[model samples]
Target: MSLTKFIEEKEVRNLIDNYVDKPKFDLCAEIKANPQTKSYALVGTAFDYLMRFHFEYKYSIIDNCHWVAHNSLVYLLIDNFKLGIEPVKPIAFLTEMNFKDIYNDSILDVKDLQEKLKEKNDYKGRQIFKVINLILNAEKEYSNFLKSGNLTDGVIKATIDLAKIDVIYRRKHYPNDLGEYKEGNIQDLKQLYKIIPDFSKKKDSNILLNPTFDKASQLVGGADCDIIIDETLLDIKTTKSLRFTRKYFRQLIGYAILADISVNIKKPKNLGIYYSRFAKQFVFNSDIVYETDEYEILKDEFKKKANKIYG
Candidate 1:
């Protein structure tokens, strides 16, 4: 399919309707003629999603904003945290800090604390705390402003806090000339929370949010699927624009393939990309994706790449 054809919303929706029912064939479990091929290979899907990684490590056409991944992890952590899963180890660090009196003299200063943490060699803990602190500050400021009926000071303070944290974190982590992109991501994270409501609310039995799927049965790999509602699989992306790149679409398709092989559901009925920044959503035509030769090649490449990397 041409790039322009893929972007047609109406045509895409029509093709997606085919996934609403149980698939006529087990696309995920279908073994190829070759003996080496396996059902729904995840390494292949990952290679397809991140084709640049195949060429060279630390390379991608997609914007590699450091904060984006951190924000994504935090969002995922928040989802699972609300599901009554005890936050443990690495994730526990995010919620283990207290921000009540961290600020001195109304100046949210953490420089000295940051230095202390560094001296103690608790780098990961410190980094996790900074991200969580920003989130906590945002929530507190937003809620308190709503309660007090004073809209101006509270919201502005929250926005400033977010920007300040982003600048500080990026200086250490990114250390490049992508200042505008980093700043944009901070704003995106803030808007993402407001756009998607009911963060703490649980859904129906069929709808599993942020559940880790173990593909150990297939012996390929395992990963977390963002949201699986009935027969549909959806992944969230918090970006400034609504454009869906080929790699992004392929990533979701790979997850659907994994879901087909591993998850209890027979086959995913539909696939969606939720752009959290503007609350925009794009549904791809999964039926076309499953049967295409391109997907087959992607799977083959993934298997080859996985063997190369693992060996």
Candidate 2:
């Protein structure tokens, strides 16, 4: 789950004010810095070829440097579709040619990403294209949901909207699949409405949250986009929540402050929460429900409550 910048900043600031004399670091920055050091690197000539140019190709010249050129062409097809939300014309081709992602189902793991490059397989060649086709089908369905074949507001009114919750993890994408420490976020969203920004199969939504900080400086929370959506700082949280909780709210509160303070924007009028339930594919994707920040309160109240929890 995600940790809000607001909560992190408060904790770090408290530590400096109460725990340390000189105050070595902000709690937000210290917490954020823990996982920044590890990024996966690619290896070998074959692997390097894939990451640089070959991977760029939908399908290119076979590894043997033969004239098949399947990798480059196929890769281009996937990239074109991925780069845009539109249904690629050649999606039908995917049904015939079967290829698989070199990496397994655990796409989140860096090892899995690397395994793609380290290994080679003819059987897996066209699998990714087929998968992209399935994603397109989902997008089509969501689109039809958006339009009611007429000007009736029914399609949109019944729709759910969402913002991407980008949790800044030093090394991991999230503490856990549903984004651990995100319980507070659920509380907020359930108060608002359900929104699903993603429809394409495995089409992930992202929001930029990581702010590069100077050593020994306060972890200022603002970033480029946070300054834009001014009325409210939305964190579209996807987590397990039949009801709300405290930890999740702090996360949203933290994000709210970061969004406002970092960009020099005014605090939003409303802080919303988004709740999406999960299935066992190790992924959370369904026409799930969500809502906005229901349990609003003063930061001091959060601080007093948080202090007790941490203690």
Q: Which candidate's TM-score is highest?
A: 1
lDDT of 1 at 156: 44
lDDT of 2 by residue, 1-311 (tens): 12334345555445323321221211111111111111111011111111112111222221211111222334433443222212323222222343334323222222332244335333333333323333334234334543433212222221111011111111212112211213333332222222222222222322212121111113332222111122433433333333334444444445443433344344455544433232111111111111223223333343353455444
lDDT of each: 0.40, 0.28
The regions of model 1 sitting more than 4 angstroms off are 1-205, 216-223, 261-266, 291-301
Best by lDDT: 1
lDDT (tens digit, per residue) of candidate 1 on 58-128: 22122211222334334322332221222222231223422222223222124533444456455454454
| The 10-residue segment with the lowest total lDDT in model 2 | 280-289
Q: Candidate 1 overall Cα lDDT vs. reference?
A: 0.40
User: Residue 102 error for model 2, in Å?
Assistant: 19
TM-score of 1: 0.40
Give the clashing residue pairs of candidate 1, or none: 19-269, 44-302, 231-269
TM-score of each: 0.40, 0.29
Model 2 scores a TM of 0.29
